[model samples]
Target: MLDFTFTEEQEMIRESVREFAQKKIAPIALEMEKTRQIPEDIIKGMADLGLIAPTVSPEYGGQGFDAVTAGIIAEELARADVTGSIPVFYLVQASWGHIFDKYGTEEAKREVLPNVTKGKWFLGIATTESDAGSDVAGTRTTIRKEGDHYVVNGEKMYISGVREAYTRGGGHITIAKQNPELGTRGMTLFYLPLQSKGIIPTYVDDLGREGISTGGFTIDNVVIPKHYIIGEENRGFYIVHEGYEYARGLISVICAGAGLQSLERGKKYLKERKAFGQPLAKFEALQFRLAEHYTKLSFLRLGAYWALWTYDQEAKGKATRFEVSKAIAMAKMFASEWSNAAIDEVMQWQGAFGYTRECPDQAAWRAIRSFAWAEGSKEIMRVIVSRELLGKEYISYK
Candidate 1:
């Protein structure tokens, strides 16, 4: 018996998030691109609604929502935020906060989770480096134990929330190799405050989602206490994947929501705008495209929710990690491509107006494009699925 219905609580969460996104996030979403910063009011609004890091336990100032519920909030934010800034902001915190809550020390959790869930601090994952994106084994950063502290060295590139965390007071859950001779087995995960004395931050101009900063930082022998370490030493390689999977699931939903919203705008335009002395809606070619895009996006939405549901099942020991990985990879692999194609067509439907900054779909197209490589590249998603289908013995990386 397969059930597709959302629970009563889930529906309420979706409706509430949708209302808030439409009323608050939508109006300022585009403005964020120009400002290059999310408005303080928007962050405050998300905090008030418990939309920031809602997955952490209520004891840590979070709503303790499940994965599906988090996906629902992400979908609404995506639909409303044309620039995709708010969705990025929400999903990163929600995903990494869950990881921190699950594996962080009680001392660290008590100090950090409450501030993050309250939106006073940003929580981010920082496993990617200039030399390594999907290959955790290639990490060059090192962390060595020094009495009561661990000193870190090396640089991380293309990390999200660097500026926010550095400026506003939070940090990334970072990974560093503690015993390079043991490869991935030697890695450790820990919280590294951006405000630490020896840390140096740098910025990058990204193609989209400009409101949230995307940049790198050099960790120059920054010392962190033992309490900041997440999970066990040499176990970061596994724990980091959990955060990535959570983020990938949210991204899948965000793509579906943004694409569907774009199609809705296109539908309205087709009905109102005259083309060849009739509405564009009457054109069979455009109508066919509209139908195809809508149908595909609908399935994408379903797949996204299904993936998130599988994640929940894994938490309850009803599904395996490999099952969750394959499902999530399948959900996210086509998410950016299909959504970008749909938005591109919507832009085509609008002719030249769609290319301008004022057009919402243009912003959406740019925003969704980044997801193809954000949490995990589409290429990596394909690899995960293939590895699952072909078994580890046939893994290409090996």
Candidate 2:
């Protein structure tokens, strides 16, 4: 038996978020690119609406929404914001905040989650380094306990929200090797505030999603208290995967929403725009593309939601972690490629105008391109699915 419908409560949430996104985020979505920042009003409004880190428990000022509900918010935001900035802003916080709420010590959660949910601080994940993006075992960052505290020394590159957390007042759940001899088991996870001493921030100009910063920080002996440690020592590699899985799930839905919305815009243009003797809609080639894209994107949307539902089921002890991982990987595997291909076809239908900066689909195309490697690379997704199906003995990189 299978049911493919959102709950009444979930439908209400989707409607509410769609309205907010259309009214507030849509109008100013492109403007965020010019400004190079999401407006303070929008951030505050999201906080007021409990849309910022809504996955955190209500005790910490969040709505305590599950993964599927979080994906709904993500989809609506993606539909509205062509720049993809607002969705990243929301998803990062929502995903990482879930991890923090679950594993952060009482002292640290009390000190950080409230400000994050209130939009007063940014919470981000910082696992990628210059030498390591998907290879968690290759992390060069080192964390060694010093008395009652720990000191970190490493530089993270290609990270998001470096400016926001550094300037606004928050930090990232960072990973480092505490015992190199133990391989991946040596890693530890802890909060490293960008505002801490000896931290130097650097910025990079990205191709899209300019509203949110993509940069890195140099951790030169940044000291953190024991309370900042997330979960147990030497188990960060496992805990951080939970956050990555959450983000990959959100990204899948976001790709579907953005691509579907682009199709809607294409539909309008096809109906009114002239091509040859009639409207572009009458062209068999374009019609086939539109139909195929619509159908594929619709299935992508369903697969993404089903992946998220699997994530929620895992929480209820109905599914396993490996199942969730494989499901999320499969959902994210084709998400960006299919979405980008659809957006590209839509842009092609618009001719030269599609390649220009004014074309929202161009921005979307650029933004979605990053997801091929963001949470996890598409190649890595295949590796995960293959690993699950073929077992550990068949793993190539092992």
Per-model C-alpha lDDT, please?
A: 0.95, 0.95
Off by over 4 Å in 2: none
lDDT of 1 by residue, 162-222 (tens): 9999999999999999999999899999999999989999999998998999999999989
Instruction: Give candidate 1's TM-score.
Output: 0.99
Please provide, for model 2 over 1-398, each residue's C-alpha lDDT reduced to its tens digit, 9 standing for 90 to 100.
88888899999999999999999999888888899999999999899889999999999888999999999999999999999999999999999999999999999999999999999999999999999999988999999999999999999999999999999999999999999999889899999998999899999999999899999999998999999999999999999999999999999999999999999999999999997779999999999999999999999999999999999999999999999999999999999999999999999999999988888999999888988999889999999999999998999997
Per-residue lDDT, model 1, residue 161, is 93
My TM-score estimates for the predictions, one after another, are 0.99, 0.99
**Pairs clashing within candidate 1:** none
> Per-residue lDDT for 382 in model 2?
97
Clashes of each: 0, 0
